[model samples]
Target: MRGELSLVADCKVVRFDAAFDITRETIGAISDVTLARRDAVTAMRRAFAELNGADVPIICLLRNTSENGLRDAKNLGATCCLSAHTPPAMVARTMMTQVIQDRADRPVRSIERGVARATEVLTRLFDGARSNGPVALAQVDASLEPIIEAVRDGGLTRWLDRVWTHDDATYQHCLLVAGVAAKFSLHLGFSASDRNHFVRAALLHDLGKARIPLAILNKPGRLDEGEMTVMRTHPVIGYEKLKAAGCDALTLGAVRHHHEMLDGSGYPDRLSGDSIGDTVRLMTICDIYSALTEKRAYKPAMPNAVAMAILSDMKGRLEDRLVQSFGEAMGNGS
Candidate 1:
């Protein structure tokens, strides 16, 4: 199969201080990045200078909405500005249907609507949804389906392997990982339910880590054996948490067994062979791929080829078929 590129559209990664509504904007080229607290012109000039010779669509985002968003973008050679408040889902859909498709003059009103919805959700979450107005997790869960539809093809995993892959907190990272995993599931010819399960697992696979001590969870160095033992409890912790939170069997399976391997080398349970089903297997593969490709305090993200090679060797330690498919996809990507 030709490798499908699902860029980030819907899974608005909100862990950072800055984000964008680039779901609709094509990235031809991004040059020098300039930050502006108030001056969009200065930022634009730097971006313009960076792409002086490159002839491609330039993309950038601002921290907050400035009156100069459009004007500054025009001068900076930016096709779009994805600010913190941009609607990720709308940006994704527009990029898919228009920018990526090379259509002209796509409607802006629809994108604005997407931004509005995203902002609303973001406000509720950051506003302490649990204790304040008490927004249900299901409400936030509803938001994910739309984002998933938008971001799976925007090259979220592939584009960030440069010098520094950005790191967001757990929840945002989960959304980003799920975006790529959901796309991978579709490419694998999984059914709608299957795809949905992957999306859910991808988003919540790390939920157990929330229980791990912060020292170990965010540790910059490799964990010691005792710390490793505590880390292994994440699967169980995550599974119980999800079960309590009412996650289904499929999602629970992924959360529980995402670490297990075919040859019986993984954690939680050294599940091997057919015991490791396709969905969990796929999650395992996607998890490794996403982690290696993401920026982290521990290490830099690996290149596609290098990560695949490591995965290939680990197949003896993981499931063979999943590794094969992952390798094929990586080759197709390259």
Candidate 2:
């Protein structure tokens, strides 16, 4: 039966008689499960108990499709209960459709959890900064781990799609930058430690914005020259706050210079090429992409192609190589 199903669908079919055969890897790899056993309900209960909170669709192929038996199966997480005599082709087709639908629906099911956790942590962190309390770097790491894992499991496109819906402009942009930076670091195959540094910098890059007045920070229109000056001070403001909190120099540099351009055209500090380190350069790319693609009250969200084109046009200001790499990293080719 497993061999017949495998031939019909492009999926790995694992056969198990009982719940004892399940493992963590099994849970991670499976999109759908088939229970072809005499004690189907008993097996499903044990299987789901071992699965913990992992969400995988289950199909039951039982000898008896009695109403009570089907009810028990449905209550135990089975999506469909069919007689054991069902054809392999029909079962395979049903399983394939379920797998495809599951992937399509994953963003809605998975990303919300990660986004909520990240938002809770950011709210606490920004509020702490506003109150002049010590920044808890450990807590920030704990919060972002779920987000990173979500992006890894669900893909960057889905993560961005959900993040763009957030109502708070400041928190939305921070989350966007963090998600993009996490994906970028993973795309570039950065070491775990280095990736953590990039993500941490992205998350806290706008820490100083907490101090900015609501009128200016949440302005419905573009900032005028005076307001622009205040906005540009955020990098330095963030740098000072994080520095005082004992942040390492690498993170401090990225936080302070994420806006700095390769040609000394950026704000707070006009440090030119080579003077800008790789960490700052990468963070700048993620920051710009997130900002441009984000929808705002005053300006509509720029399309990804348009944003990438603008980055490409900045021949002198941004690092051309990194810009191209960032486009590829975002699944939008340079």
Candidate 3:
């Protein structure tokens, strides 16, 4: 009751214009409705009354709801009963759409605040190294904790979508890569230690980009040879930066070699297929996929199918077996 009261009252709203799982008694969402406690139902009634008869747009998970609870929910204004299996992102999207439809206003600023804070942290990490020298490696890990936690917590990808902004492509790209890499690592049956190493690498793979000028990085036009040459140095630069900060060999390898191709055509080392380790190969696949799918000033975002096709065509560049594995894991088939 206190939780609901505080949320509804503190927000100065009568109706809690959000979806929640009754079973969990937590706001934002619940996975099961049938498991909702009787006390929770009573609390909902009190919350509605506190709104002075305003219709609360309570969202319930229908699959778990008992018939009695259903009666109570309808009486208490739980007008939207979503499927229990609906992804939280989908639920948020659906609720937001309905809230907008009903002319209910909710502030999206909170989500934006989180993204803004993350962007600020990344900006500082990048800028600090440039102006002052090496920031503590621990600080780097701490700064990235929220994003890592969000990915681990599940449904964060969808939640992130609710709050996504176009403010910083670099930060967004890193987050996306981390999430995607984590999923891929899981698919490949990577041990927890190895997965952690992989995720950290994905997050910091573009650390060298911090040194690159924004003009070239954000350029809408194709890079000239000189600009391309400069851009290609990011891997080496990142490798040096992380190495200076005392990151492990696996992490450093990922940061430096993510750009290396299997055909001996890659830069900084040009190590061919056999020379590239499994981890680097994995990082390469993640890096290429993330880059291809991302929208840039110079190009539009490609569809997943197109991106996979291009990856497939890069037989000499990326490991073919890993590419096939990636496609299979992504449900597109190799």
Best prediction by lDDT: 2
| Whole-model lDDT per candidate | 0.58, 0.77, 0.65
My TM-score estimates for the predictions, one after another, are 0.58, 0.73, 0.62
For residues 160-246, could you state the per-residue lDDT of candidate 2 as single tens digits? 878888888899999999889989988899888788778888999999898888789889868999999888888888888889888
Worst 10 residues of 1 by lDDT: 1-10
| Candidate 3 TM-score, true structure as reference | 0.62
How does residue 125 of candidate 1 score in lDDT? Answer: 42
Tell how far residue 28 is off in model 3, in angstroms. Answer: 12
Tens-digit lDDT string for candidate 3 (125-165): 67865674774566555434444344444433442453234
Clashing pairs in 3: 21-29, 21-30, 34-64, 34-65
Order the candidate numbers by TM-score, best to worst. 2, 3, 1
Candidate 1's residue-wise lDDT over 176-232, tens digit each?
466557557656877776676677677668767766777887777689999999989
Candidate 3 local distance difference test against the native = 0.65
Clash totals in order: 23, 0, 4
The TM-score leader among the candidates is 2
